[model samples]
Target: MLKLSEYTHNQAQVESHYLYKSLCKWAAKQPHATFIVEAETERKLSYAQALAAVHELRKAFGPAPRRLLLALPSGIANALVWLSALTGGHQLIPFPAGARNEEKARIAHRYTPELLLTEQPEEAEGFGLAQARVMTLAACEALIKQAASLEAMEPLPGQVWLTTSGTTGEPKGVVLNEQQISWTAEQVRLSHQLTPQDHGLTVLPFFHVNAPVVSLCSSLLAGSTVVIARRFSRSHFWSWIKRYQVTWASIVPTIVAMLLETEKPAFLPGKLRFMRTGAAALPIPDLLTFEVRFGIPVIETYGLSEAASQVVANPLPPSKRKPGSAGRPVGISLRICQPRTDETADLCDVRAGETGEICIAGPSLIRAYQHNASATAFQDGWFRTGDLGYVDKDGYLFIKGRLREVIIRGGENIAPREIEEVLLSHPLVREAAAVGRPDPIYGEQVVAYVVVKTRWSTQLAQELHQYAAQRLSQPKVPVDFIALDTLPKNPTGKLERRLLRAREQARFTAQDVASHTA
Candidate 1:
């Protein structure tokens, strides 16, 4: 058991607001309590040992409070470095460890951080950064082995710099203070009803905000244990859950689909409570099937990097969890508002059950993008999420799609998710994506790309077209059905509609050239 003091030097303190400070208090009360476990090596770090490691790594960072960029894989070393930087009062900028050299260099040049940390010394060359600014994880570990004197420094709350997914364009940086992170972590802890006995398994990449705030920080505030995996592995996923007796895991829809397509384990891990899915919408059919097949409930969630990860999540069993809804807002003020076209006009909230732009405001939300104070997303203290959704009379949120993603065929607007749901309901369709293609008569026409369970054929496309026509209106029906082995997705498993739209445009361009030449 760990004990946290009610007051620090006669001043009242909120334990959850400062994570590293709570960690130090936990170490003082119970030195040997388990805190983090490395899934690959089964390495356990007690509270006392974790604090010592943080201090040892801080020496390498020195006493300067500068921005530190970390480009390392998810593991014990990466966790320690992150803790070291945060507790030492340094700002953190995390880049994906598996990103291409071009991407790494682009981020490095864009942010111009004071220090760059990586796993290998040569990585600095690839990132186009000077070697003097680079610090390798191996070097940090060697320094820890030396066991130098520990320095006493006050735990200072600093900003955490993160970037958007860059799905539409270049990724923009998001700045979050420690207080915001603490608020979101507490929301996750309360939504899931986490306790000290709960054991969380983290499979999402550490570069993303989900892994750190949703998984690590939430578990820390709950006084629970967390097992960190390098990445999501379908082959080793179930085995790890059984081996560690994992109570819950945070995952994406891509992982959910992969698990359903693959074979199941010989026996289910009874200790596992549920799987939390977010970052992208999970088709309703897949969500129900996953629950029925595995005998485990799938909790659907909605979040983004701007909000520090989770905003809304379906409650656990016996709580009236809706199947396709992202549940209600947790610890935040959520409303649907008319899309802002005129900057001077007052923002108006939409009535319940009316589709509009989703907006959020709370302690967990970021004020503005880093280096982008004039960004239009922040208006009157509310962050416009750019997502189109509606709240039911009961308060459950139903996402339609992005405002930019809506297809306007002639005069009517169409939601891609509506067509996607109908396609996924077909027994033969395994995966589906809907996008708008340019048209001569109508402004834009609906096109669908699907991955079938069996071989593709001309008749199969016709069959799918017929199936959608029966379920959808004439204007909403897909004019073209394209067969694909797999739909394009981002690294985090979000469907890339922009790529599909580009493919359609190129196809039409080539066809026009052929017709003119002939």
Candidate 2:
């Protein structure tokens, strides 16, 4: 998570506005223009229809919440509510629909939302709220439809409250204002060269910042179209792209790997341009394999909830793109700074090609976490990204690993991503995550969790270790490789290093105790 700063002076001068108004304006100009479509049902909505639907949903919310909890599955209905909430001057807090009831209750209690909206009303009951307080998508749509009218209020830029991906630890709510959100969308539109003629397929969930700001909001802002899928289906991914004539899509590395694993299609989609992958460090082998297998370039991007969505991205075409780099800063000024030890102390910048904590200062960056400022550190107007990376001479950023995820073995810091990347290069390895285990002799030992295509065996493990050794330093090779059917990942497909470390500690402690007793 990045420690954000106050909005820049230029950001304050920027005309920060809501997407709802933009949608309405687009609807009036092009009533028949398609805005979104359901890939499975083929149900579609033009700009006019979508605006009307959003208005109807907005009218049903008797009174808007200071903060509204969105806990619906991915769909047009979910999008409508989100747009309505943003335009209606309500703070938005999105909850993952797949979360357990207890988890939902915990988040609900922490955020203390005035309204809980979901497609499944039964799920809202977990929050212990009255039924009347919980609104369903169908129920919101069932409201009486009045003539479509746009009511202008004193410009109150709505704030979008987001949670950290919680991939490595507990999630925290980050607050982003309208300027930040709008700037991010515009950056994505400009950086990707989006236009009204273009169409995007969105397989990412609506609850995340990338889906809304990058895929949906950016498309709408550019007067383009987006197709929303309920969930990512590797089998149907290519078919959806071809059917919708989707030019590009926002995706994660997990989906890319799955697509590579599936049998290649007879031919690529005619109109498909490229696939954008982010939210995790893309293994170089997978990136090259994906491009070779599909005949489409994989544009690696870098973003976080704190930055709204996009901070950097590989250019689409006619521009050189490094295989493993996240590309140059698109709409932000990035710097490599010595890791901050105190919030009040100023940190010096690292030289080019020097690995240090990545930091950023830009219009799109968030101002602060919802209510927790102590959790992050900001210095000299730059927010520490907590990610360890370096910039090449070409100004391309290469992420090494996360600050918290670094493995300190015998006082020498080893980036887990370097080890994971080496293991993933192996033909048999499908998924890989590296964690540090406590070692009395060396302080910590490197261990890897791998999901292999073939049956796990000691010989296979030895082969992987040898392969890693040839590429990585001797100290970087994993002491033990545990084969699992799958590695645990957060909903956004980010490897959960903390969980793996915890599991390793538990197992190691038990073994140590048993040996002492014996």
Candidate 3:
């Protein structure tokens, strides 16, 4: 049996340049150990079986390395296809299964992948790819089964092509190499202290960088088991945990908020260890309420696609944890830098407790964006995260908000998070978002959108306005409160503040036109 300490020590000594080597080592040592589970179908795959499957699936792509675009949903098949690409040294471009054909077509045209792999070949009709370039999973599986003998080839490192969430603007392509992926997986494994005994659950989509690095690759390196769900289901979340004996789960703030609204399980699973939250800012009130109600610790984390996933994560247990903090940098060098007007100038570090742009440089981070998009983000060997945050005296990071998302009201700069946090503190508020609206006098004024538990009315909006005023400064108070059935969010459950800003701008423009007509 591999003890936790022994596994940790072994992981430290192993070379992490090639993830395929590590997978092969695990298959050789623990051939029969379970590796992954399909939560919906309850199908299991062992390490040895997974390796064999990878070898078989690699044959479909031929011996030559090519860029393969995968548009499959989250499941065991998607995991296997990803592993095949990684081990076979083929670059994999993953697109969301639920994305519209037009969106997928735009990505395909931009990247120009050599092959397109999807569950339904019909969906690729308008992708502008030839029929020979399109390959369905079923067809690939059939080819694998028919092949009498697989060709012997050395497993080489591969790359992952991803894009930013594009909440602020157009998404840019990010390419992560094998070493970067392996490095991030090792860092995540070390931070979480995962071992062969642990079982993880992944509800985040496979296409997102979070699932592949934080859940799949990390678990693979640890020789642990992970349950891959089709999607996040509030009704079945607890049931899956109890049935699979899951110890940890990787989720976003949206999932946490939704889970809080649902009825608590009658009895919490004893084997479950913690819930990891990332990809967005989680309201402190919701975090506290979740811990108090469920008796499970929520480990808040911070990461971006360019970093290959996790850059900071809170310590698990038996250590001092500061709520609302993204913990400390793990396997990376992080510094808060003062904003500069010139893009070519050097960036100076900000003093502790002062908010500035969060910058990171590490082995896990990408050097540049694909197609040279957003070149300004990388400078002086550091990737400016474009997020405003500060490191405490104790070295914990507190994220304020996005640097681009700041609201300037009459020359007073305000962080939207401050207003949103105050609004979220209200019992009636379910979700809150703040954006800057165009103002004739102040240039930009603070506006808030909120989802309430009860009905929304003019009186309710007035009450929220007064509630916010008490907790915020005069300038920080929202000039207008708009009740929404729900806040606009991206596919990954991140609030799309840019969409809100656009909506406000459109409304203000319409009103201005009406006034002129009158």
Best by TM-score: 3
* Residue pairs with backbone atoms closer than 3 Å in model 2 (clashes): none
Top-lDDT candidate index: 3
RMSD list, candidates in order? 13.0, 12.0, 12.5
Q: Give the alpha-carbon lDDT of every model.
A: 0.77, 0.76, 0.79
Residue ranges of candidate 1 with Cα displaced over 4 Å: 1-17, 143-152, 165-168, 342-345, 404-518
Query: Ten consecutive residues with minimal summed lDDT in candidate 2?
Result: 1-10
Q: Provide the global lDDT of candidate 2 against the true structure.
A: 0.76
TM-score of each: 0.75, 0.75, 0.76
* Distance from true location, Cα of 410 in model 2, Å: 30
Candidate 2 lDDT by residue in tens digits, 1-518: 11122211122223556476677678888888999888787878788877777667666654554678888878787777767777666788887775655456666767778788877778788777563378786676455234265443333456678766322334566887767787888888887888888899888877778888898888888888989998889889989988888999988876777788888888677678889987766778888988898888899998877888888888887789999898878777788888767656576777667898888888777656667665555555667778889887777889987766666564344667657766888999999998888765344689999999999999999999888876665667899999988888899987777889899889889989999999
Q: Which segments of model 3 are wrong by more than 4 Å? A: 1-17, 140-152, 165-168, 405-518
**lDDT of candidate 3?**
0.79
Q: Tell me the lDDT of model 2 at 80.
A: 74
How many Å off is the CA of 458 in candidate 1? 22
Candidate 1 achieves a global lDDT of 0.77
* Top-down TM-score ranking: 3, 2, 1
Tens-digit per-residue lDDT, 221-241, candidate 1: 777888899987888988888
